[model samples]
Target: MAALEISKATRRIASTYPSLVLFQLARFFLVLATEMQAVAVGWQVYEITKRPLDLGLVGLAQFLPGIFLFLVSGHAADRYPRRTLLVLCYCGFTLCSGSLLFLTLRGLHSVYPIFAVTVLLGVVRSFNGPVSRAFLPQLVSGKDFQTAVAWYSIFIQSAVILGPSLGGLVYAAFRGPAAVYTLSFIAAALGAMSTVAIKAQSNPRLGEPMSWKTMLAGFHYIRSERLILGSISLDLFAVLLGGAVALLPVYAREILKTGPWGLGILRSAPAAGAATMAALIAHKPLGHRTGSTMLWCVAGFGAATIVFGLSRSLTISLIALLLVGATDMVSVIVRQLFIQVSTPDEMRGRVNAVDMIFVGASNELGQFESGLTAHWFGIVPAVVLGGLGTLAVTALWSWYFPELRKTEKLHSPAP
Candidate 1:
């Protein structure tokens, strides 16, 4: 009887598990693939051009279109079927991968075409971000959203850690860029398939016209949300200045004195740390005094960034990066939970777009800053200075968002 009951439970879970859950997992794999590809691309471009500025330009190329199209992307997400939109977005990304695969296969060493592809990918990502964010609520109830989101973060960070490490290893082992591109294309194709299989009940809006006016409303609403603005700003500035991921290649080659395997370890350290912490948070939500927690997490992240920048030993650097990832994960969970709980279903898409813009700007823009600063002060000093800047930004934000500092409770009821 017990064995029969166990089997029955397994069958029930299999039958009831939302397809969106699987879709999210597949999305994670593609993100992992993309991050891995990015490391390959950045390293390849830097090797060819021998210019730090070239690395910064790669991020700039992606961010330029992202900023221009983000608002419209959000509006479209709000007005359309999110699952279909996500499928289309993955399709576009796959095409970008196809182009890169072609270039690598043909031994094209020119940097311009790579930069162009990066920009094109960014354009597609702008739409993709909003759609993915808005699609989540349709899969689960509000009470489960927090838990679900925590799992989502785990998937994302895990991929981020795994992808670059794998990419570095695969590139080094194969000694050819084509293999990396091929892997990326395969992952992207899988992501599209996952997206296609995602099930959702769509409320189709009939004959709703899109306009700049609706887009402006999203911007206006975002401006009025203090917690949302504060949380996003904290992450933006802190990550922008404290970002150390972009400097991995330099660290791997120079300070670390290790090969591609070492590079993978350095890259994966933070994600590993984040995944561990995310698992803990999923079981126990950060209750009450969330605001103060966010501040301290950002502070810890900044401190870790400084330590990472200053560390000459690979062990020390890995430890510092791990701390940074763990701390940053706390801030991320807080912000995402706050945003999802506060946002009405009608506004989720545009609000998500606003959030994505802030996220994209901080990361890619931070990479540009790191690359440019590295060019000027050399890599170590540049990373150190960025860490200090992050600390300063955290201090300033503490005073600026008093309400956020005092936010003591989130009112989600039991499912």
Candidate 2:
């Protein structure tokens, strides 16, 4: 009887939350396509200029649009039908991949055209990031939302794991990026289709008049909530300093004595670790001391970065990168849960928009920072110093953000 019941429960899971399945599918394909494009661009850019600063410029192009558009993007998410917005965003991504494929196929002499296309890609992502995050709360109810967050994280990490490796393999096998971009275009189109299939009940809109005040509400709310502010800011600074991913292309070419395929594997290492951790958290949520756990995990992330920077062996480097992703997942899960659970449904879009800036800065801007430092200080010192800086930031944030340090629960409303 127990065996029969277990089989019945497993079957029910397949039929449940069909919309959630589509949401995850959309998330997976879009991210997969993006990651594939990223690897190709990084290699292509470095190959053209043979300079680290240009790599930094690539990141800057992607990041600057978000800084300029965050206010408008957040507002659009709240005012527009989110499902429609997502479909449009995915379409934008498909178009971006098509643009890259055309550029690659035409034979590139300079990196300027690639940079121009990346800037266009960045503009689309600014809107997509906030709306995608804001859409999740509506798709899953309050009771299941935390698990949904974990599962969605798994979707993201799984793509990160596969995208670069597959991109790298395709690039090497075909002797260029044309095949990779072609695949990315197809995947992004599928992402659009998947998002179109989702029929989630949209979040209710307040129909508030547009104003600077309304647009900036997300900033004010985050500021007033110390826990939210501290957690988000903590990640912004920590990952900004600790992130060494921008240097992977260089490492694969010069330092590691490898090529594009090796770079792909290195790129996927962190995500591989993150997916494993997310799957565990989905099965069993962190039950206590969420804030403190985050603090410790970030510190671990810093230490891991330091190890990755100093290591010369490929095996050791992969392990260090794995630890980097694993430790960072704790912060990712905690910060996401805090923001989603604490904010009301109406305000989620805008707040997540503000949060996107913080997180995006940590990622794209962080890549730019890494590349700049590598240009100025040489690769090893840049990475090692950044890792050490992350440790110092963690120590100080723990001291300054008493509210964050004292917080014990992951799911509680922020008061």
Minimum summed lDDT over a 10-residue window in model 1 is located at: 5-14
The global C-alpha lDDT for each of the candidates, from Candidate 1 onward, is 0.81, 0.86
Determine which window of 10 residues in candidate 2 has minimal summed lDDT. Answer: 5-14
lDDT of 2 by residue, 49-154 (tens): 9997898788889989999999999988888888999999999999999999998878899999999989999899999999998888777666566667878898
Backbone Cα, N, C clashes tallied per candidate: 0, 0
Per-residue lDDT value at 359 in model 1: 90
TM-scores for all predictions: 0.86, 0.88
